[model samples]
Target chain A: CTSPCAAPFERRRPGFLTLGCRGVSTGARGDPHSEGKARRAGRIAVCGKACLAKEVFGETLNESRDPDRPPERYTSRYYLRFAFLEQAWDRLAEAGFHMVACHSGCAAALLGEPSDDRTWNSYIEYVFFRS
Target chain B: CTSPCAAPFERRRPGFLTLGCRGVSTGARGDPHSEGKARRAGRIAVCGKACLAKEVFGETLNESRDPDRPPERYTSRYYLRFAFLEQAWDRLAEAGFHMVACHSGCAAALLGEPSDDRTWNSYIEYVFFRS
Candidate 1:
């Protein structure tokens, strides 16, 4: 069990790194396990995006019951990790898009200032994260 | 004769790339050539920095008279180009430095902006170029 499992979160656990779980229900409070079980009982079949669905059930017993194995590359663990990394890289790249001109004129200043300043300091920051 | 020599000036000539000559004598006016001669006859040897001095007359007939080549790297053409490139790179890098935290927090934001904005528009611009 991950250390997070012991520290019962009060305010509905805010999202953090989740790829480690392959979207499998950890049976933790606020986890999707109970909802999934209830939905199944009601026969209200719920389908999710393929990637998300894989994320949700890829680690459970049902995953092993299937005779065919998902490609190792498409395994929930690998896919989730890749998704996480790709999201981070995309965000970083988006933040970078804010200053196309500045990087061209002044080299030293751009390279020397702190990193967060460029993304969070100006209208550009708002543009990158919010808009 | 330089291409610029053919272009007649109405208002005072704006500065351009000028480190092609040594600080000896180019015989070109508004170029410190006549200034150097007039000052010499008038007993006012307007002194300049060694580096700047090397820049002015480094290409004229006088340069041939001197045996020293002033390290091949320090020649006007070389130094001026180097200085220009260094200054350009410094400015670009400085523009880059403005987003230090951004670069760290979001790798893409800082790298994508143009070269002038980081140094020209933001308060950081005043901080870098003006201050």
Candidate 2:
């Protein structure tokens, strides 16, 4: 609708999303071929709490520039890298996805415990497929 | 509640499940401290079409016994292995998941095209967290 959400090749189904608040934008952003089609062809994004972010991109990245201990690098701040992102890309590739983009942002932890006073940095992914 | 569905830490809210057909058992399986407390304490599962499967585990596995040409190895059969799954585990780690399991099964392509004759082999992942 208003850049609230998007996915790779959502246009293939057209009506897969019906929510007025959240659905594929059928105008400019809706058209995956509008621009950057060559690189950003078909991208899918999945965003949730920090926990889900960790589940999708929270790993002691092999290519991480930071070198610390604690399995996943227990640093002072929350950070994630492309440690196993290739797996996600590989998985989406089967569905014809040629590219993916990962993003992390802060949001109210609606699913966290009541005693905790912190926001969750939701990890999101953009999956893309080509024509 | 039947074993048709399950998740990690769903019991934290007790009444989070309201469905009569697909919800937590709330009895034996509901307790995370069961006999497998030492090993199978926390687990989560995510299953969907083969396309989703390839997104999660599809990669030229570093541990794959089969070595081929394609970037992901254009094998003769539908297969996937752990490559970037660690990223998923890391993402969920923030949520307290300690382990993850991946599974693939065949199911009717409820979302595929009408002309396609093949069933979709859904890829599933079981995520676990320890108390």
Candidate 3:
């Protein structure tokens, strides 16, 4: 990885990003830590189209600044405070991520679609234990 | 496409469901609507574990019930209200999803790992536009 892309945790810019994470708790191959660790932490720069940004960060925007008129305010901007996953995943993988359990969109991003078809690309532990 | 599974935007459960969405907006083929319309919307049931659920729905739980004691209270629960994406993706695909943008976790799920390499299993539009 390069400068900013490499050190995703330290990389920050004045732009939009849509983020999320993934973790592999079982059957992972790379690092031992990743085998049982939560495997994500970081960010990604997005072009931030208005509607897209709004859709992505609408609720968070409301919670942070204006709970009353969040959607309207979010609509006013061209960016969003996305969930911190993309960057996290990148950084973890660079460091070494084992078998990541892709959560939410992260899971979908891995599995192609959310079905029981083995044809899917993503594979997460069907059973997770409480640690 | 199954009964309740096929009829998404309707399947509702009684507990935790972390939610999120993703859209392709490019290179998709199977369904015209999916190619353009946002590529995610639905819920998946997690076998809620306290620490996991807390990490997942901490913020949302706080925002909804107690901002001050959100994390603390979340720790009390064995599950969290997850984003509604897994169910949505499963429903959409059985219904027919084309090239999807697997936002957030959905993206990670599709992409194997979040690095710029061809070895990845997931593929999404790197460049999405204002629609």
lDDT for position A42 in model 2:
25
DockQ of each: 0.02, 0.01, 0.07
Model 1 per-residue lDDT tens digits across residues B40-128: 00011111122222333244213332336442112211222232323432442332222222111111122222321111111111001
**Any runs in candidate 3 off by more than 4 Å, and if so which?**
A1-35, A43-48, A59-131, B1-131
For residue A87, give model 1's deviation from the true position in Å: 7.0
- Candidate 3 structure quality by residue, lDDT tens digits, B1-131: 44332343355211222222222222334454543333322222222212233333344332332224332122221212455444333433343332122223222212122231111122221111000
Root-mean-square deviation (CA) per prediction? 28.6, 22.9, 19.2
**Which candidate comes out best when scored by lDDT?**
3
Candidate 3's TM-score? 0.21
Q: After superposition, how far is residue A18 of candidate 3 from its true place, in Å?
A: 5.8
lDDT of 2: 0.26
Worst 10 residues of 1 chain B by lDDT: B122-131
* C-alpha-based local distance difference test score of model 1: 0.22
Tell the DockQ for candidate 1: 0.02
**What are the per-residue Cα lDDT tens digits for candidate 2 across B91-114?**
445444344222221111111223
